[model samples]
Target: MTRKVDYLFLRKGSQNWHLKLQYPGDLGQKIGRKRIEKSLGTPDRAQAEILALPYIQEHKMHLLHGHKDFRIVWKHRFEPGRQHVGPAGERIIATDRELIYLDPQGVITKRAPNGDHFIPVPPLLEQKAAVRREQLRRRGVRNSDDSIIDTYLKHANVTGYNEREARAVWSLYKELTNGKPLREATREDGRKIVQYFEDNGLKSATIQKKVGWLNAAINLAIGETKLSFNPFSAIVPKRTDSERRLPLSEADMKLVRAGMEQLDRRDQLLLRFLATTGARLSEAFEIESELMERGCRYVIIGRKTPQSHRRVPLPAAVLPFLPRQIDGQQFQGTARSASKRLNRFLDDIGITDPRKVIHSLRHRAQDRLRAAGCPIDYRWALLGHEEKTVAEGYGLGFPVPALKRWIDKIGF
Candidate 1:
């Protein structure tokens, strides 16, 4: 027959008590006693009763045989190879029906009953998962410089530059490609490219124009491509204000005029027309006979713009160099070859300043106009620039006389 057992508790000290599972031992010894106490310093019998139930349940088999107590059996359940040791020698335990073992150093190492080592769950897994999800959301995004530049080229064409100018702009874009992604291109790369042009003897204006093209490429990348920012936006080109003007002095003018006398009559008139009219070399080269009205003292020709197509007055100094009848024909030779011949004339005259070339005549005209007190408005009109206010809106058309007056004041 199976023997029934019950737990007995006795107050030992202030709050501690000895709890024994009562059962018959082999002839005499009663079941072993285990300590039961509350951490609170109170002799509360209710606390012992609550703890005694589980203790008895766990050691019920051993308790009935009178071979062990609740604590001893419980401790044995936690030890890897010793499920029969008494509580004092069992350095392991079980709770929540799961085994928990402590190393000799008293550090609790596990909570599983299978004796498997435990690891604290990492707290950052959720955060890492969120980041991974975001990365996936942005994958397959396009960000190539070529794609950006192609979009810009399409828009630039609609905005009015010819194929040649557009091609020049693209050449600048190619030079800026360091084979890195747009996001990785930095301001330092822009600075280095700017410095390279400067070191290679390029003029500041040329460098600025080249840099402007590069900046346009970067802007296109930002506005039309996937790039969110332009690395070259903040980079400023170095300025060399000293090269702004290269006007001919009176002595230099005399030498240049004398050299003109050595050329053919038509060529002499061409040089005189350029000096007196302050026309660009290309504009002057493209002039037609029909554009010139006899006795009108002004020539009207098509230029880069309608505003640029204005009457350019003939100065008295230009009369001696004019032909009896103007002929409408293209220059027989290239502008470059003609420029070389003109430079040779300057060399012969001993004007050593390289900047004192044919373009100097235009600068001299501006200088002369300023010296004669031509108003800024009149000068701008003579130069065929769009009026300041009009440029802000449309553009103003200055009367031919107003432009002619400014040119007349710049007498040879």
Candidate 2:
């Protein structure tokens, strides 16, 4: 005869709980309960215990009837109501059971029974549900593991970023992915990534640009991929005003001239040419006598723009300072070294603002031309700049004498 018994399934290796049952078969076989465990996408031992209850009750009845087959026992006990068996024959009895599975913290997930499937309420969702739940429970929330990170990298193709700039963005994204849930990422997290670069000695401008690109990637994840949110929108960098135009004052110009006087003849000529022609430091360094002799009155400023390589009329004031034969050889020093030397010279002459070095002379020339009411088009041309209007309209061939007249007015 089959005897029904109420049995509680404590997970395998679980202690402090026992399944009580009565059966007609051998007492040893019916009394000694086997451990029942279930895998339900959770790590909590309590969840395993709770999920095994119905299976345990069914198994105990089968054992009492001298039945040793688990598959048949499961089919009779838990399989009638459910379509799927839990991992190890422990069937989920109540899919909608309000049983709370607590992590180390008091965080709890209420497992509710769906039509044919058991749905687990994730911790994050539980938090939202708790606000409306009559009873509140606390539980530990586990961050997304490294698996999520692997997923991000796999889809992002981060390894394919070949440019240094693109690679830098990917590196920062990788750093942010450390055990963080894709949904938990915030704009503050993006700010910290930008700050990491700044604190590590990257320039502020570069940090700003890199952070912007990182935000773009985060947006991509949110909009194009499966990520739930973009966390970069909240970061606000500290703003500092920058001065691109560093025109030298009259006193600063005098100091610079005095400093040039102290340099050797060739170096002095280079300095004078830079000051008078307003040529970029690199363009001045690359000047050749033959190029200058071909009526190339102006040296192009190639570093900033393609149009920057246009000719400005040769400033006659600069003629006195030109080398008899232009040193066909380019200047040997790097831009940084040249800037440092120029700064040292300025410092010696009591110019406190180091910005008044070589480039400041270019600013000063532009200022002088503007102050004299020189046409904006002419000034732009002299500076090798594209005009705001049609490019061809701006006189490509500036009259040498007219340019000289403007230079004479400046009286450098």
Candidate 3:
């Protein structure tokens, strides 16, 4: 039996489930897609749901870390004077002077001057072959010549999302160490990297994150590559008391409300959603459309972190301007673009304080809750904060009506 999935829609005359994802606002123009649709190739509801998971995850990943083109790197090998088989099982009768070719669709063929058909290698084939050659070259490298950063990165067990962050750390480490091999890197090399960040005036948090990523990579290499001590181990950054940014103030909120008229409809809705619901910018933008279908009643916020995932009731004052779900997403554009536009609007509206930014609206919501005398437990649950004690984690935090009661207390 088939059940309905939010993004999986069945055409009127078709049984196969199809995924239709629409990018929000300017995101469509940037990603080169107003919407992307793909067939799930399943009539059974359960199988369709299962097949949709990867597509949904990929879409969400793109939302978090801008869009990237999708391509599958095909690996093909051809030897001269020997019969070779292609991915699709097409037999290529090789000649001694044969030249291998590949097409855009990843099909491999051979060309021979001895009256054999001339198969043109697609440009994509050359790109894939170059990558294959690099892999082969890396495999041939001895431990003495192998780069610590490169080796650890190649073998690092990171997800597609985190891979980008890991590589970014590798880029910095490679530059700092001048591409030094694992065997050659000293603890001083690690110190040099930290000192470079400090010299460049990077924030303590940013420095810690980059160093931590490199440290973890080296640690992984130690276990798998049988290296000695991690050069980055035991090199922790000292904690610093950073100036806390003021949450959205009463005057800041007024200025934003006044400036709301200048923003686009979508931006306006996003601001109101954040101000009313107190959702993180990412949480509000990437929230699932299926989670927004309570008929303007409430919206559920879910993120990678369990503590940040919770159900937030929609305030009635802001209901008239609530955003409509497009495709499977509640809002359009992206969190990044939305933040930029909102901050710019804030600057224009005379809210020039760096301590008060777009996120201050979320702070205003907390203030409203606190001023209304909402309980601490309710505040924590509504804001998706982690449980403070064992008792708070015992059951479902609160009923929707109970959550709604506190939400109603938040006057827009």
Inter-residue clash pairs, candidate 3: 2-45, 24-332, 24-333, 25-333, 248-360
lDDT tens string, model 3, 1-412?
A: 5444578788888889888887787767777777779888988767877888877765665564442322322223355567666567656655554545555465765453423223334489776876666544444434443355566667754544455566655655555666677567788878887788788877767677778777876777777756777877766577683446678777777777777789888788788878777778888866564343324356667564667677777777667775453346656776777889888999999988888888887777788999999998899878877543656557667777788788777655
RMSD of each: 30.0, 23.6, 24.1
Tens digit of per-residue lDDT, candidate 2, span 326-369: 55654556555676776677777787774556688888878888
Give each model a TM-score. 0.50, 0.44, 0.56
Ranking of all candidate structures by their TM-score, best first: 3, 1, 2
Ten-residue segment with the worst summed lDDT in candidate 1?
67-76
Candidate 3 global CA lDDT score: 0.69
List the global CA lDDT of all models: 0.59, 0.56, 0.69
Worst 10 residues of 3 by lDDT: 67-76
- Write candidate 1's Cα lDDT for 96-168 as tens digits: 3566667668677655553332223335876577565554444423345556656666766533333334444
Candidate 2's TM-score reads: 0.44
- Please give the RMSD of candidate 3 to the true structure: 24.1
- In model 3, where do residues sit more than 4 Å from their true spots? 1-163, 220-228, 234-236, 292-296, 323-327, 386-393
- Say which candidate scores most in lDDT: 3
